[model samples]
Target chain A: MNKKFLLLLFSLLALLVLALTPFIGMEKIPFDTILNFDSSNIHSDIFWRIRVPRILIAFISGSALAISGMAFQAMFRNALATPFTLGVSSGAAFGAALYVKIGFIFSLLGISGQTLFAFAGALVSIMLVYILSKVKKGFPVGTMLLAGVAINFFFSSFILFIQFISDFTNSFRIIRWLMGGFEVIGYSDIYNVIPFIIIGTIIIILLSTELNLLTLGEDVAVSRGVSLSKVKNILFFATSLMVSGVISVVGPIGFVGMMVPHISRLIIGADHRYLVLLNIIFGGAFLVLCDTLSRILIAPAEIPVGVITALLGGPFFIWLLIKSSNNNSI
Target chain B: MSKILFNIENLSFSISKKEILKSLSLKIYEGDYLSIIGPNGGGKTTLIKCLIKIYQSPVNKIFFKEQPIEKIPQKKLASQISYVPQINETNFPFTAKEFLMLARYPHLSRFSSVTAADTKAVASAFDITNTTNLANRFMNTLSGGEKQMIFIAAAFAQGGEVILLDEPATFLDPKHEHNVYQILKTIHQETNKTIVTVTHNINSAILNSNRIALIKNGKLDFYGNSVDITKNNILEKAYNKKFTFIKHPASEKSIIVPEVV
Candidate 1:
């Protein structure tokens, strides 16, 4: 608990840093300026409109991807399982892309159309994994992951197909979205996403004990006062929702989820009750640092936050995998 | 004089299209040290798995204390029955003590802090399993027998009404195997929790259990008191072998193992 507390405190300190990033760049941006400066000018516009929303979006999306990835990885007992691992990213992206191309058609539904459609897309892709996995009793981790991979491929091809035919005007936007970025974020994105993130994350945190029991093995979990079908179903959909909600707005960010949980597990045991909280805190800091590097290290032309995560996360995942295999006990 | 803790009636399970268990029915009463033994692919482990609700696939309509297993939430079921699976490959290298701490999981909610009572159970498990000194030792570092002891201790720490061991002694040395039986016997006697172990070690099963059931080809061949099984005729009939109920050649004590071919 002390270790977790320290991790949390450090994470809270990092969040403080993230909150300060817009004011800390090469330009003499100040916290006072953010509050007192007029919103009319280019500098103010860049800070309040573009940067604030983008940072919040990155924070929400990073937490969402990492937390959901932790849930998926724990449930599947697969380090490779991530927000994008099971094709949820591709599924949601495809749906959103289709909506972007056919915006005029969905404009018939009034406001919140594309985001809603994107959410639906993310939900549907997981639904595909669920349907495939649901066939033989409770969802086995192996089957769920395999289904996720297959769905990911299907959606990837679909995304490619959409990209291939998209006209000159929309091509650049589509390409940018595919590469993944944290720019041009809007307040609407925050309002649309923050509520779901809060609700979903709370439910998961509340059920952390069940998640811990699950780490012991399914039978052990069931025997220990957990209902396998109900909990797994709720957890699966809830996790998917968290990831979908974030990805629908800012696209997918990688590695924050995939890499952080294992490190926490390495620190603590496979106890989800502790792991979930630790992952959220550490994951937030880990992503904030990555995003900060993206903004400053590259200067005015910011690199996609996802790139930094992948570079760090991929190698870390291999090391953890080797460590887990070497020990050979879950 | 005993109450039925678990009742399985017409329970069926399948993997893909093939039926793993078919119309199997059995009733396990309280204080029954039951061992379900059979050959490979004989559904011994499968039956125990189903009873613990860890079958290859799910078993349909399992009953716990006359209530449907489906209706009983896992947390409550865990408070009543704890299962120790045959050791499989794992990635977490928990200490022997940490492994037993997992038994406290059922009694714990995600937000619930680990109480002293939970630690007490873990400590008790360590003491009973004779692995107290190995508390800080990594599970991966333990020898096969020591690891098995730690695993049993983990299951016992759950503090449930029943303990299910699925071949808990598999891959153990002779000394460790004997120790496992002794540990189970001590736990059953001291705690009065029902013990169900699945194994091929018929001798220990005979010695430690109050009753033994033969599970073969996904069916229960026979179920009776361990004392009754000492009868050569019944033993030979159920096992399809020749045997003599005699004392051990070296120890000069009652034993059931060596059979004539």
Candidate 2:
């Protein structure tokens, strides 16, 4: 099949999924009520206030994670690299857990205390990774990855300790947050995450050419005029900011970041120019569909979207590994 | 006398407190085909890297076109100089054409699409290297020699006057090695491009290059015309081993063979 044709077909399917997913849930809101724009109607109220905002957040967060994952994979030149590979998600989860444990109730700058703490945690992890990697002369990729893994483990253990000491309710809240979900009710969550996604996507798209050269090797990228340190710093900062923002709002959703980009690459090839756009659409639709399934899977008792993604992602990942090993193309 | 394209003045480099390139100084003139040859662990690769600014040389140590190379922005420097790194296996699946297109990075502005000039440069690169058939093929799928040619084509597509290659023909069969050198020779003669290649093949170095720089133990052992290389036992000194010099039957150029004990 033609790659462009596949891209177009996948994009159209994604658009259709995005358009249809909001209407799918435990209680189906009719398309007519959604189109009527009658906020007073109960069905319309559910469609406009509940489903729309949830889908919007889901789409935005999904795309953010996917693109960030794609960029990290390229920067590290490793297929398994994800947005959370550098511990941003773990750090954010630790912050949210700390907020639950300490019983913080206040909001700052119109942002919830939990969100603020999570973002702060992400910044700290980024700083730690940066400092650790900088100890080497060249800020080697392997060093950065190892540093991130160490930080991830450190924060993860702290979260577990916090959970161990907390009351049952607080422990449950932290556990739920760790599982990840879209329990959003209004437009506020959408407002919180859109800026990071837009800005980070722009930065990544602009550097798509550099990312292409980078996948070849550092020596190749530098010889071709990429400012290695400068590009790496900017990409790292942008991806961290985007991942931190999304994870802060929606908790730490796994698999989308690592999985979507590879699926996109398999579909569209590894050109970041097209891969970025495809990952955005495919990833967004994928999560929205998964989130909708989370709503309808058990009906009224929502399974965390994270659970659904993992359930699907683990099998898909295994299959991908097998397929790629057969062809020896990752 | 031709203009000097690169001037290295007392350049030294170190990593982890271990010196790799000692105070090295040499002049590379425009249109010159200079081959750097030495034993393993010598600073041959390091010298090529410094010239391409992969390793930052100290200020006033290296100059390109009479301007301090450190002062040139990386993009501009890349536009003036291109490098073909030692070929290695890559897992990336970028098509050969797409791979060639990335060579246009120095010439492209952020957010701008590839222009007609960029396309023409890439097409001409394929023509010159005679690897257009490999354009649509995935990079990793190509044979080692084919990949080497594509890399050279990428260097050509970069549109730089000077090309630096580190071991352009290593790990290849004899035919591919000859093909690699043949393409380099054509690029040099037809385009008048300045080429600095690092190789362990002393015979090919003497035959293909006008000048040779012999580096050993992070220092320059000799810098002179290729024909003068055999006169002072420089090969023997650089390798710390004995060699027998012989004239090539075809070109009558001086070549050397290691004398086995």
Candidate 3:
């Protein structure tokens, strides 16, 4: 734990350095001049409009996804499991598509419509999975995951259907939505997602011990004074809320939840406290790095943030399978 | 006087909804060592489950002495009587200490960290079961006998008044089986804790238990002292086979095994 804390501290410091690297390029905006009184106004615009939101988004989304991943992993007791394992991403995507079809309903409502619809969709999907399982005293794993797969497929297919029928303008917008890019990120996204992310992460930290007990299986968990249903309800609700917030704003940016927790578990053991925190830090760093690389890899034409995570995370997941088979302690 | 700690008014079993127990009743007094010997699927486990209130049967009307089974909270019930089920495939790599800590859960509140008392139980449980060396080892890494000792250690950690063991020696080696019986006997003698062991090992029941209640087709066929089970007619009726009681090789103790139909 001490070593992990040190590693996290080191990573945060490294992120600070990378965050500054953006200020020193061909467009070389001096650090202190970022908000100076005399300037071409490029420094303030770059810092406030682009760089800061991008960095903050990186930090918030990274931690939120990682913590949500840890919660899902512990709840399911499966290394491959993530928050979206129960169809949160697909459900949120479907919600966003529904919003697009209705043409800016938020202009009248004057609210962040994506976040609201995403949360509602995610919550409904979670409930749908639980309901579809034919729940007995408690939810069964095989039934729950199967329902998730079915729901995910249904929503994903609906998203594809929307893409197929919509006009070129709407289709291009849908393409960007699906392939997650963060170029136009602003303060509003941060304002919308931060509270849900912070509260959910803290609650998860407090519930870490309960999750550790839950790993011993339901009989042991229930015997240990944890109301099994309450733990499940809290975890599901928190993860859904956090993931829905992120997915609604950023679109379904897959793999942060899937790979980050696994890597964190490797660094720390099955202890959820360190696992959850480390995942957040590492996840944020990884995504921010990927998003930065995507911006520069094509220079003027930024790549989709999701592509880098997909390409890298998919192979890493496969390697985990191979490694875990050899090292069964995983 | 031995206080009646548990009473089973009726707990039956059936296959495909066919009735097995017909309003049967029994009493369990503290400091008593009772053995339940019966045929396969004779509702011994079912009756035990009803007493624990795992199933919602008409037999759930049974009580733990003065209070109804449902009335006593699960944690409180767990404190009074600990149940150690038969060994099965434990696929996960849970440690011995972690397994014992589960017993202390009923004694704890939410967010209440495990105290020195829990550590003491874990240490003593290790000492009692002689799993002190296997403390840090995963359950999957241990031998069957070692694992059985770990389960016994878990039950001991519960600090319950009554210990219910179902075929405890089912997967254990002979030496380990003897150790298990000796452990239970020591617990009964030292703590005066009530023991309810269900087993197919009739000789083990006769040797370790104070009394034997024979069951057939989910009903109590015979109930009496260990000495009373030595008769040919009782053995024949209980086992549905002819048997002879021969003195143990080195001791005055006797064993009754089936001879003929």
User: Which candidate has the highest lDDT of all?
Assistant: 2
Q: Pick the winner on DockQ between candidates 1 and 3.
A: 1
Q: Which parts of model 2 are misplaced by more than 4 Å?
A: A1-4, A36-40, A102-113, A131-148, A164-168, A315-330, B258-261
Model 2, A89-207: lDDT tens per residue?
89878887898899968887676777778878877887776676567755755456577778889999999999999999989988898998989898988776777678888999888
DockQ of each: 0.52, 0.68, 0.28
For model 3, residues A143-207, the per-residue Cα lDDT tens digits are 56567778889898888888788878887887798788676545877887777788888788888
Q: What's the TM-score of every candidate structure?
A: 0.88, 0.94, 0.83
The TM-score of the first chain in every model comes to 0.87, 0.88, 0.88
Local accuracy of candidate 2 as per-residue lDDT tens digits, B211-261 = 999898888889989888888777777777788888789999878865667
Over the true interface, candidate 3 deviates by an RMSD, in Å, of 3.9
By DockQ rank, best first, the candidates go 2, 1, 3
lDDT of 1 by residue, A1-330 (tens): 466676667677767867777675656665556665576765777788877777767767766776787777766666766667678787878877887677564432332565666677888887776677667665655466677778888988887788778886666677677656676555876887777688779878887766766666666666666777788788877876777677666666666777777677777666676677777766766666677788888787877777877788778767766765544333
Candidate 1 chain A, run of 10 with poorest lDDT: A103-112
Ranking by TM-score: 2, 1, 3
B92-183 per-residue lDDT for model 3 (tens digits): 44578777876776676657788888889778878877779998887778888888888888888887878887788887789999989988
Docking class of 3: acceptable
C-alpha lDDT of all candidate models, in order? 0.73, 0.86, 0.74
Ranking 1 against 3 by TM-score, winner:
1
